[model samples]
Target: MFTFFIALVCIVFFFLFMIGLFLTIKSAFKFFVTKSVTKKQLLSSVIGTFLFLLIFGVTAVPTFGNSSDNTKKVSKKSDGYDFKSIKLGMTQKEVSDKLGKPSSQNDRAITYGNNTLYFADGKLTGGSPKFIQQQVNQKNSNDKQKKADDSNSEKSAAQYFGSKSTQKLADQASYVPRTQISNGNMMYSETISNVKMYRIDDYQTGVTTVYKADESKDDGLGAILYQGKTVTQEKPKTTIVY
Candidate 1:
């Protein structure tokens, strides 16, 4: 946009200057070649040229001056990965091309400073969160998250692994859920081995959950029913291998 403005200004200014110069020279030649031209006509032509140049100079100086300041402001604003241009359903490659490489990225979302862009099935999702601000994708009920923490001791098992493939386990990094197992009651979670899994969609609230992995425990975790008719409540059972 700034480049366009610069080019436009130069073209318009050059065209106007050339036209004024041509008219002034033509009038001067008419005065010299023809005795019919008077002194007042010559003086009017000179004053018109001078006034035009003065007005153009006054306007052009401030225009170019403001252009420099505008460029600096735009350069600083670009630091946020052109957050204003970000839209829903943009591919990872498309976004990277516009914003350069993200500060950090995963299969789920790409982080740029305090901003994050969420993706699913390789396309950006709309209504995720406001870009260029701290991470505040609020969806979990405070009571539910607190209960989940309290129910599983201090940490919920789902807070460990980030699963980019499924909405349930997309928060925790460094590991992926082996599979998502439904625990009836409309609740679901992604399983990590046979030990623990994080809550995906809580049927109780019907809201989509985000990065919150349940803590892994050797006691087979808690109440996680892996593809069973009923949710299991048994802890990890130890066995002796003969």
Candidate 2:
């Protein structure tokens, strides 16, 4: 809304500036031809033109600043992720070292939300099969299936995001941050090591989204970390008077 207001103001100022310029030019032409133009008319035209131009230039600053800011945001978000970097044979310690502690852990598996890593002899085995397979299945499916699969991958990969450690990870990676609203939900997003991440609030089931930056353009979702119930509100009930 603020952006829209600034744009509207810019348009108004630009229109005024153009009109003032035209009038000033016409006054100059008339003065050159008639050689009897009043000083008041010439001075008023010049002043009006200069004033409108100044106002337009001032209004334009925020417009250009916003464009530059949006460009920077896009550039920051365009970064790529390589979740495949977390290999099958990586040690349990190595996985923990890379992604931080799991939300829940046991002898055979360590979990991040619904995504889990299985281990044999303290070495990493597997996690996020849907996400891993997305690249392999990219060409064999239709757009609808691809989108469905991507949504699933998002849920699976989301296990790694929206945690306390994720904030640390973003800081370590020097990722840029931004806040925006989508579908009436307020979201906070950041570019992390290998994914684009989002945290959103106010829904029946809050879901954090972790996108493989190169392929997924969908903004990340959810308010809470994966593996936990997010904020929810029950519908207000109405009772009939007895």
Candidate 3:
């Protein structure tokens, strides 16, 4: 739309210039033939020339300015990519299914059969051991609590010998789940093997940030987490005359 407007304006200015040039030539011809130019004709010729130049200048300036501005806008828009979508609790396989393979991976070893997986460009690398150990410990504690509850249930069953403890057992078995926290460094469990999945979308141009379950800082690191190629636009070219 803007391009069409600029072209229209240029065309109008070119015609105006042609009209002014014709008037100037006519005035010159009249002066030469009559040996005396009418004041009105001479004034009209000067005014037409001035008006032509002024209109051309006015039209040309904004055309160039808007063209430059649009060029920049298109360039910046083309430079970045769009992150499509993400899902929470996505396992490694699920992530691969969604985003294909990662571009790179960095692995760090953590303690107690736990590990951290870092994915860049859609591939898994490695992770920390201490964090994994903490996660293992938490899981172990939960397991121990479950075991204790089972033992208590058995004892109550032997002592009461009736259905009176059924409600109590049901109440004890009911789970009160805690909210999951994403501290960025915490390692989430992977549904496939030892690999955990995290989704991230970011660009170097600082355009958009889309994360799967949570948002993170717009550092270059997030770019590594992206498992696929980024989608972007290309700028339109303009021709310039010398």
Candidate 4:
């Protein structure tokens, strides 16, 4: 809206400026071509042209500043479009009451801009896949670091046993691998290192662990991390009141 207002102001100023400029040019031409023109008339035309330019500059610069301020205000509040009143386990009708109808929706979820809210059992179960992705990456990094530390410890033990701590184990394999799954609530995830990571919506609960898939399994050493998000809701209620 501020943009539109600024544009309108510019348009009005543009037309006014053009008219003033044209009149000034005509008066200037008359002053130069017609010897009868008075010195006062010529000075007045010059002053009028200067005033028009001044007005345009004054109006335009402030609109730009105001437009910038409006942009800041909008960015700060855009999240309020759908976050403040929404909660986990609200029915779709309740969600609509709070956030209005989603821009698009399907049986399981709805989308607003880049955000997506998923549901299971007919209630707003969860959203924020991005947060889940962050956890997956963090868990894998920790897992890989653990594998390195373990490798170093083994080398130190070998050196103590009078064996040369030569290099990485022959079984050292790919980078840490991970996977993920989410529903209305927290997710169920499995990282290649054999650690599970997930978070609740409010982020009030957190657990930390390092997984070693290679060490935990029959494999010798190394980590592979694959990732995914799963949507699950328990006893999903499908009906919506109103």
The top-ranked prediction according to lDDT is 2
lDDT of 2: 0.61
Task: Give the top-scoring candidate (TM-score).
Answer: 4
In model 2, the runs with Cα more than 4 Å from the true position are 1-8, 59-70, 80-242
Give a tens-digit lDDT track for model 2, residues 3-43.
Answer: 99989987887787877777778788887888877887778
Better of 1 and 3 by lDDT: 1
Name the TM-score of candidate 4.
0.38
lDDT of prediction 3:
0.46
TM-score, cand. 1: 0.26
Each model's TM-score, in the order given?
A: 0.26, 0.28, 0.28, 0.38
Question: Tens digit of lDDT per residue, candidate 3, span 1-242?
Answer: 99999899878878888888788788888888988988988897897778778876886778887997889988656433212222322345554464445444323211112223344444333234333345546667888999798555544432222221223333433341112235322112111122222322233432222222223645312222223333233234688999
Please report how far candidate 4 places residue 101 from its true position, in Å.
Answer: 2.9
CA deviation > 4 Å runs, candidate 4: 1-15, 23-38, 73-82, 112-115, 121-242
Error of 2 at 164 (Å): 61
Two-way lDDT contest, 2 vs 4, winner: 2
Models sorted by lDDT, best on top: 2, 1, 4, 3
